[model samples]
Target: MPTPDLLTGELTLTGRITTASNATFLGTIGELVVVYKPRAGESPLWDFPSGTLAHREAAAYKVSEVFGWNIVPHTWLRDGPLGEGMVQAWQEEDPSQNPVDLVPAEAVPGSDWKQVLRGQGEDGQMVALVHEDSAALRRMAVFDVVVNNADRKGNHILAMTEGHRHGVDHGLTFHHEHKLRTVLWGWIGDALNADELEGIDRVREGLQGQLGQQLADLLSAEEVEALALRCDRLRSDGQFPAPSGQAPAVPWPLF
Candidate 1:
């Protein structure tokens, strides 16, 4: 791990993350590979407070740690070449494993896969958007719900060689509203397993103590209350929630 001063050292941009809504860069601090998203480069959004996306990214990492599920990679906030931004460890996804795939509609049947939705592919063939029903992916879905993640695009999931799945690009989170939008809704309406419910319980307990205090440093008071409320709702409901029916359930350009 790079120390704060080392991470704040000169950032040499290796490449730009063009698909991001805001300006993002792939850079390195000495031998460590990192992704940097400067606050100055953030495009303002009407719903979220201005210029705090980088902070939210770091907060999401904290929440991931709270759950003891390594769904999110190590992240921090520091000054970079552009401005203050979120810096995260770079994950090299397995070249052979695709996290999300468009398989033929008729070709999907295995219990190991969860079909998220069906649509027509560019080739005019009926296809199903599917992801592996692995424990890592399931943990990520739970993390999304806890944070009220507004955008969980398919490509945000990284598949590592040993089958570990890491979620990235969590800037659109911690909203005080029901802004849960994502492609990982395969477990909709499913009952929460005992372990999953226990995780939620731990989060609820943390909100009244250390986790809540840490979140206060990165999020607004209202957002912190909303976070606690989400834990309450999930605990009471005891299931993965379905779409609220008030907003789009999934993000556009799913990939």
Candidate 2:
């Protein structure tokens, strides 16, 4: 839960999120900025699914700790213009980073295509995709795959000038299926390195313990099974497993 002071809405009204959702860019509350995602009225693909948006955000934040990426922000349970919502940390936007635009691995110097792909602007213009460190980014991507991140678009990655790429918008994560899709596809078939394998081991160990207990609150039984399947594949193959069945790679537009 977020502290009362962080939950207060005032100066933030001056700003808003450019995304399609009913999101508002709440002013920075500490090291993090807050965003409000109100429930959608009536969408075609999905209809708020009844009552799980905030909880979905909560579960993703918790699962993020296990993955080692800081995508989920500290959410304060509060009422929003739409209804109850989560107040998330604001990620500082930097122009140096490319927005989900695919960059060729060869064009970027010193970047190993096998390990990870560094993002560059479409016209061969140089832009920071995920810092110079491809190793760290690959690990996070693997974690995302393990969680079955339904969305991992390139724009979701916010590259800071100081050499860190932060991910945002995780309200639709942790579902129990092969619903993985996103722009971070640099490591589609590359095998997981040692440290990467070790991290999966940690998550597997945690799943049956306190983590599983916690996931229970946010995931359904089928979803939990999906998570298990992903981990099992990673552990067995040491590489990203192929898609099991034919599933739409992307979500509906309104979502």
List the global CA lDDT of all models. Answer: 0.89, 0.61
lDDT of 2 by residue, 52-156 (tens): 656666677776677665545465456655566666776677887553443455444344433223444658765433323366467657767787777666666
Clashes of each: 0, 6
Per-residue CA lDDT of model 1 for 207-252, tens digit only, reads 8898888889999999989998998999899889989958898888
Give lDDT for model 2.
0.61
Worst 10 residues of 1 by lDDT: 1-10
Q: In angstroms, how far off is 121's CA in candidate 2?
A: 13
The per-prediction CA RMSD against the true structure, in angstroms, equals: 1.6, 5.0
- Per-residue error at 169 for model 1, in Å? 0.2
Which segments of candidate 1 are over 4 A away from where they belong?
5-7
> Lowest-scoring 10 consecutive residues by lDDT in candidate 2?
39-48
Candidate with maximal lDDT: 1
